[model samples]
Target: MRLPRSLVGWFYVSPLMLVLIPFFVLPMVVIITASVLEGDGFGGIMPFFTTQNYIDVFGSGLTFNLYFSTIKFTILTWVFSLIIGFWVAYFLVFHVKNQLLAIGLFLVCTVPFWTSNIIRMISWIPLLGKEGLVNMILQGLGIIDKPLEFLLFSDFAVVVAYVHQLTIFMIVPIFNSMARIDKRVVEAALDAGASRFDIMRYIIVPLSKSGMALGSIFVVSIVMGDFFVVRVMSGGGSASVVAALYEDISVLQYPPAAANAVVLVLVVMLMIGLILRTVDIRREIAR
Candidate 1:
């Protein structure tokens, strides 16, 4: 059943396959080798393989602490991002009739991405600093005589950074999902005396599950893998999972660093697997 035309298809696709095998696959093999073997600080690989990395991943007490902290942030960020993103997306789909205005709104959501994350983080300093705008305003308003010490280096700062950076990622997916939903369904729901809440709860949410799943996964993964959010926003006094991994690497603990990285990967994968299992992601994807 094969055609001569298929030969041309293979010939064109062969280059990408060649590139993938060498760059992507080869680097993965090197990472696995390095993760298994001990590495000298100067890049020499020792000739031994052990499960100590894997063991340390599970056994280290602080690893669990980092893991738990990251999970806490991931869950919180996901919920908040979804709620905010969904609202933004809904407004774009249902409320905004002017396409130019909608585009402007989306651009508003996207402005943060144009700035470097480090720069964006540094920008927060002025607002949250001791004599920054918020502090100055509060002091002037007689709300407090002293600057608030609760602004930066806190979970609030972490969440603020996470939501700021990742909201667009969540919004785009949810917005795409919302745009694809059938208008007739909403109209039908309304014509049948269904309230706005009913349209959202019964029809909209069910159809948007795929987008929610995608957005949730992205938000959780980004938030979990992040350190800079906690660093700049939290004033380097706090550590998320990636920050914890960086701490291990900073001290030249290769085995522990590798172990920590592997553990982070596993935890992320486990969460993704759990989501896929619960959602039957294959079905949603097929749609």
Candidate 2:
């Protein structure tokens, strides 16, 4: 017996739905439910429904501060990652003549991923620490009189760690998008008296928007959701929304933490929705 068209589609998506429902959707539902419930003072959840968790989340100045810090990191990381990732992808796509060479170069970018993220993050410390390689070299060259204390445990370090880890995410999607561009179209534009800058401004940038949007979404979401980088790199000086949530969780404040998580999820979804509305990623990928 033949199934209906909708049923056929549902069958095709059944595996994905099975995975998402159990892993993603169920966790989110639980979190949302917990957000409205009261927490017993000793790490237990009470059955009583209350809005106090959300009220505490919104009414607290700490929430706004945490969000401000998180957003600041997100914006800085996104801008730097985009600028670096776009140019790297552009060079690989437009400048590299040999396909094998381009592929090899791309593989080199993934070398860092072979290691643990924590290890990679910690590795920056020896180089950026006040009494470390960077400071030693600068001191040898007389670039500064004393060690630069701001390098390791500051906002700068946090952003540096985020951009280092996340730039690869930007590069992958942007490279994929740029690789799909027609070389002949670029040549045609050049033949029509369009300069390099003109081609990049009109053809390259416009065509790469889908990839940029995708990369932006990745960078934004990761930076916002992350707490470890902020907490460790910033030396407990800077705190993100997730970091604050981590604190709440550590203190057995599950209900408040759940409320914060729900709010964060909504904000991230809103940002992603805006990106999807601006550029249909699925449609672009299909093309």
The best candidate by TM-score is 2
Q: Which ten residues in a row have the lowest lDDT in candidate 1?
A: 38-47
Collision count of model 2: 0
Question: What digit string (tens of lDDT, one per residue) describes model 1 on residues 1-287?
Answer: 76699798989999998999899777656666667787666545677887767776777787788778888888888888889998999898778988788878888888877879777766777887787898999999999999998787678877877887788888887777787888888898899999988888999888877778888888878887888788777776667888977876777766657666766777788988776665766766676
| Model 2 regions lying over 4 Å from their true place | none
- Model 2, span 7-98: residue lDDT tens: 99999999999999999999999999999999997789999999999999899998999888899999999999999999999999989999
Using lDDT as the measure, the top candidate is 2
Provide the global lDDT of candidate 2 against the true structure.
Answer: 0.93
